[model samples]
Target: MTASKTLNVGDKAPDFHLPDAEGRMISLSDYRGVPVVVYFYPKDDTPGCTAEACAFRDQYEDFKQVGAEVIGISSDAPDRHARFAGKHRLPFVLLSDQDGAVRKAYGVAATFGILPGRVTFVIDRDGVIGHIFSSQFRATRHVSEAIDVLGRLA
Candidate 1:
């Protein structure tokens, strides 16, 4: 399949419907009129991923205060996401993008064509992307960067 074009600031965020850890369907349109932070990570329970998730968990209230919803996506199954979220007490939704369809739609390129890319997108209430941050090695920074942009949007 052809790679999807990379997303950029000011572009409309792609809408998607995916299952959360509990297997309940979630749609991007469901979050319309509120800012959303969508982050794609490589795997569940990995060191960097854990750190990144915890960082987001710790600051979840801040995001809520700004009226933004945070969502994490990975190729992991819903059961794996459930375990990961439970293990870390993550307060946000962890989505199962098992086939990486949403990942490709967001243009999250895999690292070296092996590991999945770590990228975060902050979409404004109007559905336009406000910021896009990608850094496979600096996973935790994704949380901070997204929050920073949300602060501006707020």
Candidate 2:
């Protein structure tokens, strides 16, 4: 895969329309005026991805309480995403970016020599990136850190 233009803090998130686990179309514009935590992962139901998803699942209520919405995106197809979300009981939507359009747009697609790096983009109510977290193993911390940042903004 070619290197993609990485989105940065304070940059407006690239708008996208991807099918969720249930095959319902979702878009960044739909959530305008709401803080959003959009996370990108490698695959659905994989060990690392599960950990990351579950971490967000565990924190779903807290996120909603803060007036934010959390959404996970991966290159998996909608059917795979459906099973994964059902199996894990994920509360938030799991977007299917099967063609990697959104994944590449975010610069998180796997490249020649690296596994797809995990990335989190925290968008404030005005739709500007407030924080970006990149990690593999300790993805749980990303959720915590995002909550902290959102709290400060709140």
Candidate 3:
């Protein structure tokens, strides 16, 4: 039984308050007035996931210049997340969903989806979801596409 709804474009983004690597609580509501790119991945350290993270890291400034924040979410524990972030020098926050609550809430939590299929949600400043990208091969491009979509919306 999947708890995720088929989130549509323009839908209100589901609010969440999860802990970051440093154990700081990060909430979706906190970024309400700014465009947000929330991406879900499977684990902390992996090839595809690493590529995806590095891609975002590489363009971290572009997203910021465009007035957007990127957040990566996964079921990894805080310790693992901390290691991954430090290893990659990721500038964005990576939320820890240890129990998969956030994942299930977003409907991307899957068993076979072990290597969580890439799902990126681009949310507008008003906290409304503007676009959803569901593709693994294009995971690295998710951030760029999200910035483009959010730029148009802005």
Residues 53-82, candidate 3: write the lDDT tens digits.
Answer: 999999888888889999999988888999
Please give, for residues 1-154, the per-residue lDDT of candidate 2 as tens digits: 3336877898888888999977899998899999999998888878889988898999889999999999998888999998998998999988988778787877774634467768899998888999998877787787898899889879
Candidate 3 least-lDDT 10 residues:
108-117
By lDDT rank, best first, the candidates go 1, 2, 3
Query: Among these predicted structures, which one has the highest lDDT?
Result: 1
TM-score of each: 0.97, 0.92, 0.92
Q: Give lDDT per model, in order.
A: 0.93, 0.86, 0.85
How many pairs in model 3 have backbone atoms within 3 A of each other, for residues 3 or more apart or on separate chains, i.e. clashes? 1
User: What value of lDDT does candidate 3 attain over all alpha carbons?
Assistant: 0.85
- Model 3, TM vs. native: 0.92
RMSD per candidate (Å) reads 1.4, 2.3, 2.1
Instruction: List the candidates ranked by TM-score, beginning with the highest.
Output: 1, 2, 3
Candidate 3: regions farther than 4 A off: 1-3, 109-113
Clashes of each: 0, 0, 1
